[model samples]
Target: MAKTQLNVRVDEDTARAARERALERGMSVNRYIEELVRQDTGEAGHTFVEAAADFMKQYESVFAEEFGAAHEGRGEGSREHRNEGRR
Candidate 1:
């Protein structure tokens, strides 16, 4: 895989905070930023589907209470119908 360099400019306060936190964790500022980017990339961390599933699992009880039974497959009120009003 090819690697590229990225340069970002952050506010003084944010940079200070990042540097302090990185030092506390015994990691360099670059490594801390790299870990964050890797997590967001999904391919290296959790895929979007896996992340969504984990989120739903964590909030299943709250969602069930608010929205009632969770729909399985394409039931009566599926998200597939979301674009029906667009046309």
Candidate 2:
């Protein structure tokens, strides 16, 4: 994609908040703002939930065969269960 530079102005408090948010995400303020715009405009790519569902659907049988015993009684929501480790 072709990149273009945009100049924006905001109050000091807003700029500081942007910087803090960007820092927390380990991204530069420019990239953080870019992502915010993408999400707001619904141009963002597939979300983690969508991707994770796809992955679980693809490997569900394999996981069942291997980990079925361990997952016994945990119910059918293994997808949510598997995501616990990420947190």
Candidate 3:
């Protein structure tokens, strides 16, 4: 499925906590945050990942059409070309 990027800002303390908790779970910060969001919005026996896959399967072409060909055939999310925001 095509993947996109999301960036968020938080205070240092919040960032530290996310780092520590992600470390405790032995997962990348990205996957850890994904798990947290999954738990928050998920129903028992159904995961956010499953729902996401289903949605993507159903609407991926629509997204590619709406967003443009640049959004097509994308793999994992990338930050390689991002412009840094001002502090």
Candidate 4:
């Protein structure tokens, strides 16, 4: 991949924070910012649908336990009697 230099300006406090975060992550400030952008943009590779599916799968048992019975019985009782023989 081709890399380009990007000049950016940040307030002194922001710059200090970024430097500290970069050190904590064992990355250069530029790399830390790049990773952040990549993750935010989903260029880190997982698509939105894939991410959502994974999240749902992780908590699927919780949802099923909570609503499975309610959903299962949702349409069992008819609201009104229908005219079965006449159109």
Which ten contiguous residues of candidate 2 have the minimum total lDDT? Answer: 41-50
Ranking by TM-score: 2, 4, 3, 1
Please provide, for model 2 over 1-87, each residue's C-alpha lDDT reduced to its tens digit, 9 standing for 90 to 100. Answer: 899999999999999999999999999999999999988876675575688899999999999987887777575577677887889
How close is every model to the real structure, measured as TM-score?
0.45, 0.54, 0.49, 0.51
Better of 2 and 4 by TM-score: 2
| Per-model CA lDDT versus the true structure | 0.81, 0.89, 0.77, 0.84
Query: Tens digit of lDDT per residue, candidate 3, span 1-87?
Result: 576799999899999999999999999888888778867776423865678889999999898788766654343443432333322
Clashes of 2: 0
Give me the candidate number with maximum lDDT.
2
Per-residue alpha-carbon lDDT of candidate 1 for residues 10-57, written as tens digits (9 for 90 to 100): 999999999998999999998888877777776654576788999999
Candidate 3 has its poorest 10 consecutive residues by lDDT at: 78-87
lDDT of 2: 0.89
Residue pairs with backbone atoms closer than 3 Å in model 3 (clashes): none
Q: What is the lDDT of residue 27 in candidate 3?
A: 90
Q: Candidate 4 residues 17-77, lDDT tens each?
A: 9999999999999999999888989887776678889999999999998888766665635
RMSD per prediction, one decimal? 9.7, 10.2, 19.3, 6.9
